[model samples]
Target: MMSGRGTEAVADAVRRAFVNGMGEPVAVSTRRLSPAEADQLLPPGSEGLTVVVPEDDVLGALLPGITVTGAVVVADETGARLFFTSVPVGGQHELVAAGIRAATAELAAEVSRLRTEAAVVDALHSVGRQLTAQLDIDRIVQDATDAATKATGAAFGAFFYNLVDELGESYTLYTLSGVAREAFAGFPMPRNTDVFAPTFDGQGTVRSGDITADPRFGRNEPYHGMPAGHLPVRSYLAVSVVSPTSGDVLGGFFFGHPGTGRFTERHEYVAEGIAGYAAIALDNARLFDRERHLVGQLSRSMLPVVPEIPGLDIVTRYLPAATGSKIGGDWFDVIRLRSGGTAFVIGDVVGHGVTAATVMGQVRTAIRSYAQLELPPADLLREVSELAGALFDPSFVTCFYAVHEPDGHTLTYGNAGHLPAVLVRPDGAIEEIGEALSQPLGVGSKFAERQTVFEPGTDLLLYTDGLVESRTRDLTLGIRWLLSGLPALREAPDVGAACDELITGLTGGRHDDDIALIHVRHRAGT
Candidate 1:
C-alpha cells in the first residue's frame, strides 16, 4: 500500500512543479474546506493540491486510486468527505504563485467535464428505462422524441416512419416539444431530397449548422422549397433508426433549431443513441404483434369445429393461460361417433407453448384414430395413455372424455388424472361424475369408466382442471366451487350461454392455467 502511495507522491511532486512554486501547500475541499484546513492536509511548509472527490460519486476511469501525485491529485476523508492532494513547487516561486491560480482554474474545468459525462450517463439510463417500459409503439416513439429534444437542447423534435404503398411511399411524423402540430398538419411530407437525404435513406447521422446553405439543396418534386407554414429550421441533427436484427430502416429522428449553430457534435451523438433505442423498441413491438397473430391462427386451426348433432346442443370454449403469448395446450373436441353417439373430449397437456400444443395435437389425433374402433371409455383411455407414454415419456397430461348416447339416455365418462365433470340435473340437483380416476396420460395406469342416466334438459359439463383450480385453493374446494357455480349456469337458455357463464364465473378471464370446456345440454326428447 505504501509503495502505491509512493507513486502518487512522486506524481504529485511533478504536478506541483508545473502548477506553481508556492511558499506552502494549501488544502481545499470541493465542498466545505477552509483555508485554515490547509494546515491539516499538509505540514506548514508542504505544497500540493487537495481535491475532494465525494465518496458516493462515481468516477469512470479518471481516478483509479486515492493516492496520486503531480497535476492529478486524490486523497481520502471521513464519511461523505473525500479530498485529494496537489502541491506546487518551483525555483521561480514569486512568478509560480501567479501561475498556480491558472492551475486551479484548469482543475475546475476538468471537474466540470467529468460532471457533464456523469449526467449524460444518468440521462441515457433514464431514457432506456422509460422507452422499454411501455409496449405501445406510438407512445414509445413520442417519449423517445421528447427525450432526444430535451437532452440535445433542440427547439423541436420529430420522428418519421415511412410506409410504402402501391401509390408510392408515405411518411408518418410524430412531433413533439418545439413546433405546433398544426404547422405540419396542412403540409405534405417533405420528399427525400436536399439536406434530408442522408437521414431518410439511413446513410447515418447528419449534423448541420445551416441546412439551406448546403450544396445538396432541394431538388425533389412536390415542393421546391419549405412550405409556408413549416417551422423555421437552421441547425439540424438527424439520426436514422435502423433495426439491429433486420437492418431495415424503421424511421429517423429529426431535431431542428431556429438559431444557427445551436447544435453540436455532442447533440448528434445523443440523438443517435436515442434513434438506436427507438429502432429496438419498434422491432420488439412489431414482433410481439406478429407472434400474437400467429398464435391466434394456430389456436384456431388446432381446435376442431363442433359438429351438429341431432337431439343435443353442444358448445365448447378454450381459454389459454393469461401470460406470454397466451398460447397453451388446452383443447376440446365434439365428434359424432359411428354409433351416432356424440363424443365430448376436453384435455390439458402438462405445459405451455408450441411444444405443449404439438403434444396436444398428437394426442387428439390418436384419440380420433382409436374412436373408429368403437371402444368403450375405459378402453379408449387405456389405449390413449399407452400411446401418450410412448410419445411423451417424461411429460404427462390430464384429460376428461365422455360420450352421450341419446338412444340409451346414458352418459358414459372416463377421467385420466383430470378434474371430475359437473352434471346439472333438470330437477336442480348437481353431481360431479367420475371423481375417481387413474393416472394421467404417459403414466401407463389402468382406468375405469362410469355411467349415469340423464333426462332431457339436463346439462353435462366436461372441463380441464384450469377451470376449477386456483392459486389459493385445492382440488376439493375447487370442486365445491364448481358444484355451487353450476346452479347459476343452469338458468341459461342454451348450452352456449351456459358455457360462457361457466367460463366467466370460474376464470374471470384471469386464469394461471389454460382451460378447455365442453358443455352439452340434452334436448327434451328422451
Candidate 2:
C-alpha cells in the first residue's frame, strides 16, 4: 500500500521503471490511501520495504548551495536510505550515499527508543488497574507475575512472599506464572544464596544477561547454582517489592528465560514498575483481612446463648453478610425476664462494617437492661427506641420483641418496622402476625403491643430481613416463600433443624445480607 500527497506520480514512476526493465506492458492502478490507513496496515518496526518523497521543500530553499529538485527516502527493516531524483554532472555519489545512510540510522535509533518508552508506560498503567481491583494477596501476586513475565518476554516468572498468621508466626508463600505448581512442589523454599540474596534483602534489583557467568553464581554449597530438575535459565531478572508505608520488603519477583541474553535494561524497568504496584495491593489486602477478623470476633461475642427454660424449646442462628467485611448489625438474644417470662429479641441496624456492629451491641444491651424491669413488649420497645434516637444519629434500626408468658399460653409482641413473624399451629395452619407493626426505631413512631393465645404444640418463627429478602427476590415475594415453608416445620425433628431447613430453602445456603433467626416451640404437655 502507498500513501501521501504524490501517490499517483509515484505509481507512474514505478510503472515506467518496470516497463523499461522488463521490456513488457504492465497494468498499474492507483488509489488514495490515508497515512493513518497505511500505518494500520504496516505497524511500527514491521518488516517490509517503504519508499517516499520529501513532503517539505523549505529545507532545500534554506540550503542555497545545493539546488535540490526532488528527494526520495527508502526504508526497510535494516534502516533508512536517502537518494536524490537527479545526480549532478561528474559528482561522486558514493560519499553522499554514505553520509545519508549514517544520518538515517541515527534517526531510526531515536524513534525506536521513544516507542519502547511509550510501551512500558502503557503496560504499567494496565497492570496497576488489575492489581488494585484485587483484595486477595494470592491473586494480586499471580496477576503481577503474569504481567511482568509477558512484558519482559520471559519463559517463566514467580513471586515469593511472606505472611504472618494470627499467632504472629511468619511463613513463606510463592505464586508461579507460565508454569504449574507441581514444577516446584518437590523443591524447598529458596535460600539466601549469593545470587538471590540481593533481591530478598531489598539491596537492589539484579539483572543478568547470563546469570551463570556472574561472580556470585556457584558460590553456595549443595548444587552451587540452580538445583537439579530446575527449569533452565540463562537470562534472569529480579526486583524486590518493598512496602511504601512500612519500608519493609514484602516480597521479590523473579523472571527467567532459557535463551541467552533474552532480557534487556528495558525489561528490568518494566519488572520494577509491576513490583511497586503489587506491594501496594498486597498491603491493602493484609489490612482488610485484619479488620475483617476483628469485626467477626466482635459480632460473635455479642450473641447470647439461649438458657434452658422448662416447657420451651429455643433455637437461634446468626449469619453475617457474604461480601465486604463479612460483618453487620444483625443480632439475636433470648432474655429470661424477671416475671418468669421469656423475651425473644432480634434487631438489624442499617449499613454494615464496624460502625453497624457497635450500634447493634449497644441496642442489644439496652433491650436486655429494660427486660429486667418486667415491662410489656410495647413499653420495652418504646424505651429502646428513645435510647436509640439519642445515641444513633442519622441511622435507623428494625427490631421485633416478643414475650411468652409464664403460663405458656399467652404471647405478647411488638414490631418496629421489622418483618412480620410466622406462627405454625399444631394442626399445620399458618398465621402471620403484624398487627403491632410500626416504623423502625429512631423514626419517631409509637409502638402498640398486641396479644394472642399461645396454644400448646405451636411454633413461632422470627427473623431479620435477610431470611426473606435478596437482590433477586423482593420483600413481598420473599414473604410468600417463607409462608409456604412454614407448614413443613411441624415435620422437623426439632426447632434447630426447622430453622436450618427454612434458611436453606429461602436463601439456598447463600445470602448477601446478615441473618438473625429465633425459633421457639411450646411443648404439648407443658
Candidate 3:
C-alpha cells in the first residue's frame, strides 16, 4: 500500500479483501516513495508475480520471519507507489499481480515495434532521394548497393549489372559492399541457375531464411552448392531491377548473411523498393552517356588540324569542358593563305550543347570562306558579322582573326568583342593588341582592324575566354598571370612544348570550361 493523503480507507479495504479471499492472516504496510524508487520495485516490461521476502529488521519487528510473498505494484494519478505485499501462498493476490506484470511487458514490446518501423521508413525515404539525385552509372549502382545492404541487415551485398560497349558488346559488371572485391575475384559470373533465374529474369523477389536447406540451392553444375573458398551464407535475398519505361531488366541485387533466419518480410519489401529506385537511376545514366558520346564526336570533328607552314611554328590545343559531357563552342584554326601567308582564327559561341556547337561550326566555315577572298582583316570580319546577324541571334559569337603577310613581319587582326591577343617581341617585351575591339558578331555594324609589325623571333598567342576566366579568378587577374608567365616561353625547346607548358601552368590541368589555344612563333632566322 502507498501512503497518500486519503488512501488509508482504500488500503484497509483491499487488505481485508485479501485476507478473506486467502482465508489466512495478512498484514499490510504502507510506505511513501518517489516514482523513481517505486519503479525499482516494478520496472517496465517486468513480467509475472515478482515477490520479495522481508528480511530487514524493521519489517521483521512487526512479523518475525514472515514469508512476504504476493507483491503487487499499482499505478494511479498520484504515481506508481501503490505497492502491496501479502503473507499468503497461492490465492487471488498472486493472480492479480501476475496480470499487471504481463500487461506491462506486452505494452513495452508494442512501443519498441513502432519505433523500429518508423526508423525503417525514414531510412528508405533518404535512400530514394540519394538514388534519384545521381546521373553517373557507377556511383548510382554503388550507392544503391550499400544502402540496400544496410537496410536488409546483410553481412555482404553485391549488385550485378549489364553494360553495352561502343561496339554493341554486352558485359557484366558488379559492385560490392561490406566485402573486398578480391573475395569474389576467382568466382565466375553467376549463371541463370534455379535459384538465380527468378531474380535475373525479373520475375519476383527471392528471400530464403535458410538458403542451404532450400531445395533450389544445389542444382547447378561444377559448383553444386557454393565453391570451397566462398563465404558462408545461410540466409539469402535477391531482387531484380527493372526499368519502368522499357521494362528491361537492368540488374539484380543479391544479399547474404552467415546466420540463419536473418531476413524477414519487411526486408523483402524494402529491397524491392530500393530496386525500383536503382532501375530508374540507371536508365537515366545510360541515356545521358549515349547523348554525351554523340555530341563529343560532332564537336571534335569540327576542329581543324593545324597546318605545317614553313618558316612559322604553330601549335594549337582544344580541350572540352571538364564538368559535364555537354559540348562547348570554343574552336581554333590555322589556314595557309594562297599568297604564302598564314591566317590564324579563334572564336567562342555563347551557350553549350548541340545548339552552341552547331553555331560554332557555321561561324568557323564563314570565317574560312571570307579569308580565302583575300580581304583585309576588317573587311573579312564585317562580312562574317553581317552573315551572323542574319542567321543567328544578336551577339551570339565572339571572334579574333589575324593574317600574317608573306614577309612574315606585318600582322593585321580584327577583334570582335574577344579577349586581347598577346604579342611577345624579340626583346621579351609584352604588348596586348586589342585596339580593334567591337561588339560581338551580329551586334556591331562596323569592325576595327589593327596592324602591327612583328620582328624575327616574335611570339603571338590567341585564345578564347575560357583560358582567362574561371570560378576563382576574374578575367583581369587571369590575363595578368598569363602576361607574367609569357617570358618563360622564350626558353622552351619547341612551340608544341611551350604551348603545353602554358596551358598546364595557367589552369592547373583541371579547368571547368572549354579551352582553345593558338601559339604562333615567327622563326628567329626568318
Candidate 4:
C-alpha cells in the first residue's frame, strides 16, 4: 500500500515489476489486494510506501508489504490506483524480485519433472502395446528419439550406437535422428572420419558451456561437426549412450546452441535421464531385430529342410504379417500321424509374441499326439481342446486339424473356431469345408465338436484372421473372395505356386496377418 499522495509515483514503479499483466487474465495470479483499502492491506510499518487521497482527491495513502514492492494503475477520484509490484532494498524490486524469480524456476522445474515422468510411463505403455506387435528397430528408434527430444526441448534428437557392417567391424555414429542423412543426404562416406576426439570415447557424458574454453577441443573430437573456431555453439552437454542391459556406452545424448543461458547442471541431469530411456529402448530394439532375423531364418529353416515325404508332394509357405513385425500366431504343420495317414494343422494363437508363438507350438504338439491315437475327428479336437485348456496361455488360440487317409482317399478334420479351409478338387471343383465350429482351443466351452470328411484330391487351406480381416472389411467378404478365386488355382499344378496365387488374389497382395499354407495331393494308390 502507498500513501494516496505518492500513489501515482509508486504505481509507476510497480508496473515494471510483477503485476505487469494484472488486467489481462494472469498467466499466474497472486493473492488479491485492494489498492483503495491500502491501510487495511498493509502490515504495521513506519512510512515505507504510503499515499492518501483526501476525500475524492489524491490525498494520502500508505502501503507496506514486502511481497508487493510497488504498483502502477490509473488514478481516480479515490486517492490513486495501483497495478504491478516492484523490487525492494538494493533496487526498486530486490527482495520481492528475487523471490519471484526463484519461485518461477522452481515451478518450471516441477512441471518439467512431472512431464518427464509422464513421458517415461507413456513410453512404457507403448512398449507393452508393441510387445505383441514385436515392433521393429526403425519405429522404436523414431519413437524413443521423439520422446527424448521433447523432454529436452531440443529442436530434434536421436539415439546412436555402434553397429557392425558386413565385414563385422564395429562402427560408431549418430543413428537415431535423421541428422546424419539430413546433414549429408547426398554426400559420400568420408574416407577417414575422425571428427570425434579421443577423450570423448570413455567420458559417459561431456557437456561444454563454452566449447572454445574446453581442452577436448585441442584433441579434435567430433563436437558438433565443425572447426572449433567456426563452431556456432556457445554451450553443449553430451552424455554417453549405452546398452541398458550390458552397461556398454554406445553413443551419447547431446544438447547445445548459441543461447547465453546455455544449459545448467540440472539440464545435464535431465538430458542424462532422457538418454537412459532412449538407451534401453534402443538396445531392446536391437535385440528384437536380431531375434526377428533369426525367426525368419528358423521359420524357413526346417520347413522343407528334412526333404519332402517320399510319396507326398508337400508345399508349405508361411507369409508373416506385413506390419514390419514377425510376432504372429499363424502356424502350419504336416506331420506323419502314428496312424498310417498324415495329419495337417493350421492354427492361430489368440494373440502374438513369444507367448502366442509358444501357445501355437503347444497346440501343434497336442494336436499331433491326439491325431496319432487314430481317434475320431471330433475326439481328436476334444482332446486338443482339453490340453489347450490345461495349458491355456491366457491368450486363446484357434485351429483346424485335418488327418488325410490317402489309402481311403478321404480327409477327416475338425474346426476349433478356426477359419474355414478352402478345398479345391481335382476336377477344378471347390468346397469350403468344416462349417461347424466349437469354442476356440483355449477359451469358452471345454471342447469343440466333431470333424467332417473331404473327398480325395481336394485342396485344403487354413489361415489366420490377419489374412482376411481388412481395415474396412469383415471375414465374410474374405471367404467369398477365396471361394471366387478357386478357379485361378485349379490349373496351377505346383502346390506352392497355387498357394502363392490364391493368397495374392484373396489378400489383394497385402497381408496384415500371418499366413500359413499346407497343400498335399492324394496319390492314385495309397
Report lDDT (CA) for all predictions. Answer: 0.71, 0.78, 0.80, 0.58
Cα-based TM-score, every candidate: 0.74, 0.79, 0.79, 0.56
Candidate 2 clashes between residue pairs 3 or more apart in a chain or in different chains: none
lDDT of 3 by residue, 150-208 (tens): 99999999999999999999999999999999999999999999999999999999999
Runs of candidate 1 with Cα error greater than 4 angstroms are: 1-101, 129-136, 162-184, 212-221, 319-322, 427-430, 465-513, 524-526
lDDT of 2 by residue, 356-440 (tens): 8788889899999998888887888889889988888767798888899967488899998888888888888889896348888
TM-score for predicted model 2 compared with the true structure: 0.79
lDDT per residue as tens, model 1, 1-526: 1134633553344334343444455442232333444334432332234332122223222345643233222332221122334443334322333354355547656766787888887888789878876667778888898899998999898888854433556656565656778767887665577677788788988888987776665555655556666788888788899989989888888888889988887788788878888888888776766676678778988879789988777778877665457478888888789898878888888777878888899999988877777788889999998888887747668788888888888988888887788888888888878876777888856888989997797988888778878786676777677888777777766657777777777767777787788878887765
Which is the better candidate, 2 or 4, if ranked by lDDT?
Answer: 2
The superposed Cα distance between candidate 1 and the true structure at residue 51, in angstroms, equals: 8.4
Candidate 2 Cα lDDT to native: 0.78
Q: Model 3 lDDT vs. the true structure?
A: 0.80
Q: Ten-residue segment with the worst summed lDDT in candidate 1?
A: 72-81
For model 4, the local distance difference test gives 0.58
Clashes of 4: 46
